[model samples]
Target: MAGAALPTAELTTSGRPILLPNEIECSLLSNVELEPEGSPPLSSSIHLRSSFLILTTHRLIFVSDSSAAAANTASYVPLASVTHIFLLKKSIKSMFGSPRLKVQLSVGSDGRVGGMGTRSIVATLVMRGKDDVEAFVDKFRQNWGARVWEREKESESASSGSSLVVESSASSSGFDSRGMRVVGVAGILRREQEMWESTDKSLQDAFQDLNALMSKAKEMVMLAEKMRLKLLSGPSQAGSSNDEELGSKEEMQDWLLSVGIVSPVTKESAGALYHQQLSRQLADFVKIPLERSGGMINLIDMYCLFNRARGTELISPEDLLRACSLWEKFDVPVMLRKFDSGVMIIQNKSHSDEEVFARIKLLITRPDALQMGVSAGDAAMTLGIAPAMAKEHLLTAESRGLLCRDISPDGFRFYINLFPEIRTDDIYLVKDQGIYATWIKCASSPSRLQ
Candidate 1:
């Protein structure tokens, strides 16, 4: 049987290597390679051409651009497999030659490096670029020594234990405290007991001190997570939840879910490649939120979301703008788009105006919408997007002649583009079959026409 092919590493749409959870990029260098230099040649040829080497907390990613295509493929070497990293030797002969960094790794019996069952393999990285080899080596060593993967493993285990605790607690009695007698006045006694616990001298004093602030902060984060969980389960419970209660619950959940970013990439951590790293992290971070926002999110809203996620380490608007601007240089699924009106938004690169236009066309052709032009808010509800974003889409459709705008004291609204289809020469003329005719029939009804 043919040997198992290496597990193909996953990549982001923009060609950036997808990092493991808690994995942080330490350094990035262009024009680097990995090859077995002195090993006896095997039956199969191993090629190591020009590749981008990314050093991260968990692995070293080799991003190789395929000569046949515009896109690149990535391969990774786990840091755990590294037996020893060979320090670069400085010699007069090396002064005029390309710099090289070598690493000794354990390759398993199956020829894969790292993991419990793997043997060992020796690999060398040739730096062909004019970049500082010494700096790259320093970063590589730093990342290896950090042992971030181990820390992440520990954290995962700890969190799993905490989840189990939460599950058990949730299944048990309503309250954690257990010290009350059963009697006729037991219910009243329990209430008084709870009040007395609240009034405990130590507890009362704690609230008056700095500990209260700390406790509140922790409670706030937990509350947010709880609310998010409720929102996630809300639709399933909708049958039992009244509409008004559900609406309020949904609003509260949205607010809570928007409370934070558990972890965020920062300039201090990513260094010179901060923007590039931020761009990639932003791409990953926005997928869910963007989908919920109807594939387009205001730059201001994103800034707030991003900063909130970062928690105490908030980034300035300028930094956020710079990071967004860098998205063009990297292969990211989401891009920073500026409307003609100068309003900026972060939109999925795959998001098409044609799709929105098609939806809008369908919406306006509806009997109700035809009679009453769709306001920004009306479009917002129909499109499931923010009103501001919906207005932008409407304006964009109008610009493309897919729709027409009507400004009235009531508000700015859009109607189906009947301009081209309508016979301007004869105001009353209606084509037998067309959007205009359909719209006319709908509009002609007094009850339908507002």
Candidate 2:
């Protein structure tokens, strides 16, 4: 923890920072450190090492690059709180040492960073990499000058205040701004109709052209996220939802969740570190879908899901593959695996083949399974995975001597590998107690085979 001086940034399971509502990442630096300036260190002497600097439209975030506590080890300086940014000075000493950019931040007496404070502190961002530090500083200055967050705050404040003003005026004057009566059910109905008309007009205008849709994309993403959250809380908050309603809500939630990525890592934003940052973002994005697919998903399926979430900012297949390849260098929980058949998939490092094999063993050892064997489709249903993935597991189990493959006119099926338990010398000899014995008992029952 960096203590109370700097608020910690929230991160997803795969270590990507959670971007604010409309905050967009504008720049990224792979290597940087946050160091306090002056001798009598300003309240707690906050310091971060080997951190990746991410400059968004709203804040300057420093995220630790190391694997341990990567999720928790992040702090940000809101652009709103930054009083001044001093770019790296051109001097002979700068030639031999790392470039440093100084940022003056508003600090309160409580030793916390905020919008306005009685005192201020100067913090130095030590840029270790020689990779385009000038560009990042330029972007920092640009974002600060834009003051977009302030504009958003002003808009939100105005919108919220407008409704109260209307209600207050209507109550006092007994009429709305449009001269409609305020004391009856007809007034309420008229207001509701007006709201729906406005919404319909907005929707119609948004779909008028591609450029119109592009402009409204952010609003749509925000609306989707809001609806998804509402659906998520609906069941828990209401408690009266039936199974069908709950199931439908869950399905709708899944759809809305994939509607968009509010702040996607892009080549323009990440620059030289594009693929690396994209890899981290992709790793974080895949966690949910991977879990749903039983801890593994084909790379093709992942690409589709990822690009869908990214919306218009789609990546080329080559870029996606390159990003996935970089995962081995990072300490992410997920990894890309290529099976013997050359089928590539993304699976968790903690995913155990033995656990999957155990499930397969249980499925195949049943009396019905023992008599007729199990097909890839059968395993797919039992495992809740794709038939292709199920087949891979079945083949791996067969290779490990846990099961045996049986091909017949009906279809490809896997049966328990009882060769190890069988007596080769005696053709009819069966083990009194073992998998072979179980198979014999099941085979002897005509009804079971049928």
Candidate 3:
């Protein structure tokens, strides 16, 4: 059945709304409704029923109940469209019934609540859930008064000009007294001197007190970001940058890029919702990091990286585990995986040992790998993953009949999956057309070039 016309709002794959950059979720309620009260006789004839209301810092989203035998749809009422919110009338009769808070919102002439510069329209909110009415009202007032959206706009504008402003000021300071000199030994010397001075000053300042270090953390993060941008733009500016300089610049950029998390979730910040919210945020945050780590990352390694990015708001290992366990409750794209060896990792849900096995199979089938078998470190480099993670992948593949383990004083290693190829009836037999024959041929060759 067709439902009432409702505005649509986008939701992330994890079911969270795609908030504007810098916008944060404040409060969430499961089930609520909206309806107009005390309208004209003709207008009052229209009835709106139970729905789920989500109160964000910027908008009120009403999602219609699915069982309404109508299209489950969402409508958004921007906070900017709200002019006044009437307090719930307190009385014995009101206290006995469900709490209903009325909100006065300005709607356009076309009878839609919006902020597209149209005339005002009045609307009311009827809360039918077991929630703190006063709390919701207070949040609404706080969000309206804070005007965070406006502040975000100002911040974006400031950041856009910050680089240009800094460059102009630095140019006026006459730091570059020498006219265009070929960037060679002299440039490297000057850069080394600047880095040493900066590092020395930072070390001295950091030792002053814990509080001083905490205070300087944000500036340190900004400095790192600035340095990363400089490295990224340096190659573009220097037409004759050497390969060695470019490689160093890339390394520096990577180090600096890992430096900060502007708004890390903390136990204090998320309160009772810490684990749940952290799980979702961590799931969102780890995608790129996991991809860079080659589809899997050790839980302990992730804990360190996460805590380092969080700076002072360090969470306990227990908290990290709890957050990881909560991934089952969410629809995030990543999962917390535990190997038989009791090692834990965060990996993409789609990441499979079969894929890693395919790569390992291809690697060890080569003449060199066939002869030596692949050590954990060798596999780590070949698979582009951590040595421990690669070992786990290799073990998993071994269990799945795609590889075999080799343990000796030389160290634990994995070889091509010869178990399936080797005839159990004739262990020494090498089929002319199979991987066994190819592997034997590669293994027997004195020089791989043969």
Candidate 4:
């Protein structure tokens, strides 16, 4: 249990594997077992049964099922350490019971797992779950044979040489005179212009097919992160820059952050647990946006923002709703809320409605707001929330006797509640300086002033 022939895998808060850079999930199976068939039980035999199995481009991951009686820690076998994946026996017994797969792993002299060594052990994966065993087997072979892990090394080499390649490509495409005094946003734009001009072929190839687009995914995220870092470092380094330039750099940094999700949970990868995993990812993604939007965001706006960050893996509106709904089952910091009017929004659970109400209370008491009142749009701008949601809050305030509504040529508006100040005994009777009198005075403003 302590030292197995496999490396311990790290999991996210929601118990999903934390993938390697550029790694992609290929398949998953629940309630599987990893058994070692040696003369005796091998010391590396994990003794883990009925666990979850995940196959990715780089590793075969095992997760403890939630219902298991033991501690839930994950373990993985890197395809880099896998020496062989034995052929399935396809016997009649296998067709009746659970299916099993055997893979040879490289181990150190002491029989401990390592990236590579001379000693080896055949790991038998027993599939006891309701998964497509054949599909799992097929993908396992494809991932093992493809050896995509090797591509990461090659990609690193290429990336190290990318600057030289980019310079050559730029020179070939006539990227202005090198002496052009480019700097700041203008400089970034100028560089992008040169890159686009020189990489027109890559742009065209990217959209040629879905496969081509998939290949460009990493580069896109890297570019976004790179720009984000540059923008982040710009202001500190910009001693002579104007306010407008610094502001533009900050805004550009936000956009770059929003545009990149290095790893998005996809339906193809998560399978039946797609919505659950997507919910966890969304919960994490929305925190910064929610903070920037004042602790809440319109569901529709988030849908657009989330999909934009997702790039080609766009989801349906229904999928978004389902993912939001799954947050109830997760311990994420955010929650989905639906107003009485059927508008949906996501807000931090710790966000206080009392603070929002306090803001609205102060807004309603403003001298101008007290005289003419404020519209839903006005409250929205003040509260940094959607107009529809702001209206809901205003209505709640009205119900609580904290505010009052008026509909007139000025459109529907909310004012601090003055109904309790009016004396019903005599309509003519008004307190000297009460809110009722103040309201009457404001209500009688000159038509020309109105």
lDDT of each: 0.72, 0.84, 0.70, 0.79
Q: Which has the greatest TM-score?
A: 2
Cα deviation in Å at residue 86, candidate 4? 0.9
Q: State the weakest 10-residue window (summed lDDT) of model 1.
A: 1-10
Write model 1 residue lDDT over 1-450, tens digit each, in one string. 111222345776656677776565667776776666444542022335587677777888777754221276777778887778988968887788778777887766656545663555556688877666787789889888878788778977998998987577545522335643333456556756775675465345546867674445544565457658868887885687788987888778767766554445666544555676677677777887899888889999988878777776678898889888887776667889999999999999999988998898888888888877899898889889889888888899889988888888978878888889866689887779888888777878878544
TM values, all candidates? 0.65, 0.78, 0.69, 0.77
Indicate whether candidate 2 or candidate 4 has the larger lDDT: 2
lDDT of 4: 0.79
Per-residue lDDT of candidate 2, residues 1-450 (tens digit): 443467778877656789997888888887898877764455344667788889998988888787543433778888888999986788999888989888888888766787558778888888997578888889899999999898998989997998898788667745654876666787677777886787788789889999999778776666677678878778778878789988898889878766567788988888887887899899888888998998999999999999998887999999999999998877789999998888889999999999999999999999999999999999999999999999999988988999998889989999999889877789788768788888888889979545
Residue by residue across 192-211, what tens digits does model 4's lDDT show?
Answer: 88777756776687778988
Model 3: per-residue lDDT, tens digit, 333-355?
Answer: 88899999999999899987777
Ranking by lDDT: 2, 4, 1, 3
Ranking of predictions according to TM-score: 2, 4, 3, 1
Q: Over 4 Å off in model 3, which ranges?
A: 1-7, 38-56, 61-74, 116-133, 150-277, 304-331, 417-444, 447-450
Clashes (candidate 1): 10
Candidate 4 — worst ten consecutive residues by lDDT sum? 39-48
